[model samples]
Target: MERPSLKSWAEAAPRLVAVAAGRDTADLVIRQGIWVNVQSRELLPGHDIAIAEGRIAYVGPDASHCIGDKTKVIEAEGRYMLPGLCDGHMHVESGMLTPAEFARAVIPHGTTSMFTDPHEIANVLGLEGVRLMHDEALLQPVNIFTQMPSCAPSAPGLETTGFEITPEDVSQAMQWPGIIGLGEMMNFPGVIGADPKMLAEIAATQNAGKTVGGHYASPDLGPAFHAYAAGGPADDHEGTQEADAIARVRQGMRAMLRLGSAWYDVESQITAVTEKGLDPRNFIICTDDCHSGTLVNEGHMNRAYRHAVACGCDPLVALQMMTINTAAHFGLERELGSIAPGRRADIILSSDFHALSVETVIARGQVVAENGTITVDCPHLDWPDHARSTVHLGKTLGAADFEIPAPAGANGVRVRVIGVVENQAPTRALSADLPVVEGLIEAEGAVCQIALVERHRATGAVTNAFVEGFGYEGRMAMASTVAHDSHHMIVVGTSRADMALAANRLGEVGGGVVFFADGVEQALVELPIAGLMSDDKAETVAAKAEALGAAMEAAGCKLNNAYMQHSLLALVVIPELRISDKGLVDVTKFETTELVEKVLQ
Candidate 1:
């Protein structure tokens, strides 16, 4: 379908006004509400909104002049009318649901707009996968804009992905209808060094007059960061400290502080605005990656707003962070982010600013949601059979595949371990001594064996390494196909047999998460779509995710958001230690490390 031309929309203005003036009839009219003017930061009471042709035609004291006899009237009953929330940065696949289901889950929370990067899917299916996500997003009741994925392997040579995205691909995608901009440029090193491919992608986005997303995962805000900024990324979401937030804004990049399902970055970074008095407009709130459980139970962008407010930001400032600030940064200020003329008529009715309970939601002049229920349809795409049958294990194996063999005549060995920090993205690299049982190294106390099983192809390769901070006590295992970037299978366990059982179960189910203990499966969440998302309803997925969480705790694994840590094991871009299909990656030096120790012959 072709988009309506701007000139054509402007030509219809007289008809819209005629409908609003009662000469013709409006489709919907909302009456008697307090308008929360974001531009002026004032709550003006006793206003009515008249909608025609999916746009706000009139908003004033008395819409009785605008309301025709046939118009459907909705009494707002003195609730606060605010523009619907917008997420500045996110990954749609992280919700473990398709775009349609993700829209259904967040619409009740008043999130009407989202800026998404389907990089995870792009890594698996390439440009075609991105187009599939974009087409489905355009079919939703709310707005879900796509950013062409910039980094596919994320870090070149560190890991191998199922597909590769080139500069030509980036150029072609810039012309896509829903392509908002380039996805997060995660390869900061590439940008700083002026790699031709990275510069070409940025040039394409700039030539199209769109935004460029950023991901500088390093803590060094020195010359390297300056070089990255010079390379032309307009916004960044990897800031975890007040200095990080302040630096990004000073460099003319919007500082996006995120509060995802696992990442608790807002509390530490919001102080840049609240305490240090930095310009709040330069900072935005986002949930970069949220699970379906967090969206359905806790909230979506609403949760991010409440978190910012709880962190001492003004309530109005928090709301702006999730709305206008985001829209302006993404170059969509004229189309969204405010309850103003010519903007898409997406508004939310709430009772309180602090609590923020959405009573009603309007998208494109239509009643999309009311009283925590979606009223409109969000269309879903029929996924191809190839996408569903992605999980591949060469052959089902026993516990022997998970065993890590030690060096000759070794009784004890010192091993480098990846330390999982609770509720944070970066993990610490620590070394520990463990007892060697026979020829195999065993996890004695706080450490456990983590394996990255190749699931993209039927390679049947498993890379084993040691990790700490999960605090697993019993002989249990947790396996997941939600591994980031590469989207392989990650299994963490104290017992090899249980790990094997968990991995084989995921292979049998096609894709999902599973927990096993003492030769029995405890919980499983089947995500058959691309092995990254489930076709089930949000509530059903959340319930199963919650059960999986409970099972993780019951098996003696004690870490906040351990499931997130489990998913990120294959993400080689992040610092410290990670495992890929090739070998164990020591990210601190960006080199591959062998599982065995080097010794004199």
Candidate 2:
């Protein structure tokens, strides 16, 4: 389908002008609403909005003159009329559902706009994957804008992806319709060092006059951080501390504090606004990654808004952060973010600003959702069979594939382990002394074995390592093909046999997550779409995901949302230690490191 040109506003101008001038009737008129003006930061009562051609024609004290016999009228009954919420940064794939299903899940939560990064699919299917996500996004009932994926492998040399994205790919995607800007540049080191490829991508987005999303995972607020900020990323969502949030905004970049399902960074960072007295315009709220379960049970941007309010942020300030503040960051303030002339008629009705009960949701002058239920269709693209059949594990594996050999004649060995930090992306590079049984290292205590199975090239390569946390004690294993950047299969377990079973189960089902315990399959969630997302409804996927979480708990793993931590075990860009297809990676040094180091007495 051909995209609507920028002259759409011009085309709708006659109808809008007619309605505003009281010469013609509006398609819809919402009367007597308490306007929560995010742009002006004011609460004005007795406001009536006139809508025509799916755009706001006029918003003022009264629209009684614009009402006609055919005009559909909605009495707000003294409800707060708010602009539809906008997500400044997120990954649609992380929802474990297609863009259509993700929109279905969040529309009722009053989210009408999203700026999504499709780098997860890019790692598996390259530019073609990104285009698929983009096309589907445009078909949604709400405004779902795509950002050209800036990183496929995410970190060059540190990891390998099934497909590599080139600088030309970035340039070409910038021209694609509905592409807001370049996606988050996860390769911060590459940007700081002025790598040609990274700079070329950044230049392409800038040349197109678009925003550049950022992801600086490091906690360092030093020279490297400043250099990355200078490398042309307009906004960042990886800030986990108040200082991190303050520094980004101070440097003229939007500090996006995320509150995803597993990532709880908003509480720590929102203090920058409440206590530090920084200008709230440069701050944004987002969910970097939310699973299907979170979207179904809690909320989307609404959840983030509520969390911010609970953290002592003023309700109006938090709403602005999610609405106009986000829209302005993407250079879309006039086109969206408010109920004003020429803006898309995307608005929400809430009974209380503090409670945030989204009673009614309006998108493009039509009621799309009301009272936690979607009213409009979220169209889907025809995802071909080839896209579903993405799992390619060169050959079948056995228990031998997930084994770690100890040094010769060593009774006990000290091994580098990836320590899982609860509710955070970065892991700790920890060392543990473990028992060696017949030259084979065994994780008998708090440490467990982790392996990265190469599914991209089907090389039958399995990089074995150890991981702390999760507190697994029984004979069980969990496997998933949702490993970040590379999209490889990650298997973590106490028993090698169960680990092999879990990995092979995913390979058999094309790609998804599998949990096994005591020689029996405990639970499974099938994600046939690039092993990252499911075509199934978000609710269905969430149910299965809840079961998988239960299975993890049954295996003695005691971590909140442990599946999220399991899926990111192979993310080599963030922090201390990660497993890759090649070997164990020490992310701090960005080098492959040995598994075991000799400890002398």
Candidate 3:
């Protein structure tokens, strides 16, 4: 399908003037709605909106004079005419669905705009993959802007990607129509250290006059954070605390508090606005990584808005965070993100501010979704064979591949474990001592085996380590190619045999997520697109994901959205400890370290 084109303000200005002056009929008109002017932060009741050429032409107390017999008008019935919600920063592949499918799932939730980072696919298929995502995103009826992935490996030396993204790639992607800006710059160390290549990538984006996304994962509000702020990143979404949010906004960076499937950073950081009385304009709300279940069962940006209201934030402030604030952060204030004249006619009809029951969603002057159902078709791209065939594990594996060898004649070993914190991106660098049996350290109780398999190059290398916090019982293992930063295979299991089986099964079917327990395959979600995203419908993938959740619960693992937690084990950028293709990464230190702390004789 050709990219959906809407007239720019320059092209529609003549008609807009005619329509507003009551000399011409609007393409669409909405009557008697509470106009939510996000720019002025005011909710004016009883107004009409006139749209022409897919752009808002008039919004006032009445647009009756602008209506013709050909015009399509809807009675808002005193609903709040909110500017459509815009997600400032998100990964479309995180939902395990392609861009088209992801849009199909979120349109009903009043999400009319998205700024997606397709770095997950870039890790697997390079620039071509990013182009593929960019192309499909433009085809959607709703706005889905693609940020040129700035980090493929995410952390340059910490891990290796299937394909590395270069400065040339960044410069070239900047010219693409859908390429809004560079994706999150996860290499904070490189930025502060003034790594030339990292600086060059930022330079390319800056030279192109686009927003440079940020990802400062550290909690240090010291000079390091200040240096990173000065390094040209315009916004950051890795903030987890009130201080982190406060520090970022004070430094002229938009503090994006995200509420994803497993991340609950919004509530903690929202207090900066609610309590300290900081300006809400510099604070944004986004979903950094929302899975399909969250989009389908709960909501999208609307979910984040509701979560903020529940966090004691004023409803209008929350709406601003979800709408105008996000658009302004991306430098798209004049184009979209509001119901004002000269903007894209993307608006939502909601009856209540507190409950925000989205009754209708309009995108580009078209009714895209209504009453929890999509009314428009989100176009799909024909994915090539190379895109689907990404999983390339070198050889078959066995239980030996996951074994951590004990030190010479040691009875017990102190291991640096990747501690899983429930519902947060950062992990704790905890240590645990376990007994060794026959020259191998075995997983005991809460401590399970975590292995990073080299699926990118088919190098047949497996880095073994231990992780705690997921209290799993019996023989079970889960394998996923949706590992963050690097699209490698991460398997966590009690039984090594089950881990091996799950990994092999995913490798057999291209790529996806799978669960195994008691020597039987329990659940699987096939993501054939770059092993990171599925071409199937969002509902289909969500259903499969639900079964996988059931399997996780059956194995006695009871962390909220444990699958999301499982996928981030290989995310080396977020501190404090994470497993990678090279070795155990101490993110706080920004170097590879030993898995074992010491050996007990």
> Which structure among the candidates has the greatest TM-score?
3
User: How does residue 50 of candidate 1 score in lDDT?
Assistant: 81
Question: Cα lDDT of model 1 overall?
Answer: 0.87
lDDT against the true structure, per candidate, is 0.87, 0.91, 0.93
**TM-score result, candidate 1:** 0.96
For residues 167-235, what per-residue lDDT tens digits would candidate 3 score against the true structure? 999999999998899999999999999989889999999999999999999988999999999999999
Residues 1-601, candidate 1: write the lDDT tens digits. 2232222247657867786666876767889999887777778899988877777777788888777677899898898989999999999888899998999999999999999999988887889889888988988888899999999888899887778999999999999888999999998889999999999999999999999999988888999999999999999998888999999999999999999999999999999989999989988899999998899989999888888888898988888898889999988887788887667789999988788998898988778899999998888888888888878989896799998888888887888888888888888888888888888888878999998888887889888898899888788989988888888899999889999999999999888999988878989999887788886889999999999989989878777767888898778877878888878888777789876554222
Full-model lDDT, candidate 3: 0.93
Off by over 4 Å in 3: none
TM-score of each: 0.96, 0.98, 0.99
Which portions of model 1 show Cα errors greater than 4 Å? Answer: 1-12, 17-25, 594-601
Candidate 1 lDDT for residue 174: 95
The candidate maximizing lDDT is: 3
RMSD of each: 2.1, 1.3, 0.9
Clashes of 2: 1
Clashes of 1: 0
